[model samples]
Target: MKKSYRIKANKEFQHVFKHGKSFANRQLVLYYIKKPEQTHFRIGLSVGKKIGNAVTRNRIKRYLREAFHELEAGVEPGYDIVIIARQPTKRMNYHEMKKSLIHLLSKEKLLSKK
Candidate 1:
């Protein structure tokens, strides 16, 4: 995703965690807060240390980012979204991860309906 569309502040992520609504499947969690003043969505990815070492965590993050990038256009434009990878995420390939992401976001009603 573009840097402009990424949520970079730890404070923002924390706020989202505290105030945003969340939905999840077996592999991914979606947290979102409506930010009507903002013109576009901002996304954050969180893959924990327990998932693996640096390389594995980074790889998981990359897959999450790619899924978000593909889904961004179909998502509503005024929210702060955080995608958190669960433990099962370590075993998933890109397509599985993407499918899990879409499932989580669909529950949140962010993505356009199929």
Candidate 2:
């Protein structure tokens, strides 16, 4: 994911958490708000230090990002999405992470029907 498309600032993250609607499942919490333009979706990832050390946190974030990228085509355009990692994510492998992410997005109605 590119920095320009990521929600990085504290203010942005707070805004999304405060204003955006949320959906969740066993592995993740997704907060989303519709944006004006229908060009592309902006994504933000949150993997806390509480999950583990820097290495583990980075690994989780990377797996999440890869999962998101694979599912990007299914996501609706003109939305800001924040994916917050949950404790269960630490125990999950990459394939499990991908499946959980896709399932959550489907439940949130963010994924397009194939």
Candidate 3:
């Protein structure tokens, strides 16, 4: 994903966590807040050390970023979305990870109808 499409600041992530609504599945947790002024969505990915070593954590982040990129056009614009990987994600492949993400986003109606 592009830098402009990511939430890199701790403050921004915290703001979304504190003020946003969230939804989750066994593999991933999602927190999101609407930012109507923006024209596109931004995302923050968090993979805890508890999940694995650097390589494992990085792989999870990569999968998430790709999943979000694929779902970009269908996601509701103007939202700050943060996804935290769960223990289950360490064993999941890209397609499984994407399925889990889609489940969470759709549960909260964050995916656009189109």
TM-scores of the models, in the order given: 0.94, 0.93, 0.97
The residue ranges of model 3 lying beyond 4 angstroms of the native Cα positions read none
TM-score of model number 1: 0.94
Give me the runs in candidate 2 sitting further than 4 Å from their true place. none
Better of 1 and 2 by lDDT: 1
- The order of the candidates by lDDT, greatest first, is 3, 1, 2
What would the TM-score be for candidate 3 when compared with the true structure? 0.97
**lDDT winner:** 3
Task: Summarize candidate 3's per-residue lDDT along 1-114 as a digit string, tens digits.
Answer: 878999999999999999999888888889999999999999999999999999999999999999989999999999999999999999999999999998998989989877
Residue 79, candidate 2: C-alpha displacement in angstroms: 0.7
C-alpha RMSD between model 2 and the true structure:
1.2
lDDT of 3 at 99: 91
Write down the RMSD of all candidates, one decimal each. 1.1, 1.2, 0.7
Question: In candidate 2, what are the lDDT values of residues 6-102, reduced to their tens digit?
Answer: 8888898888899999999988999999887748888999998788888888999999899878887888888889999998889899999999888
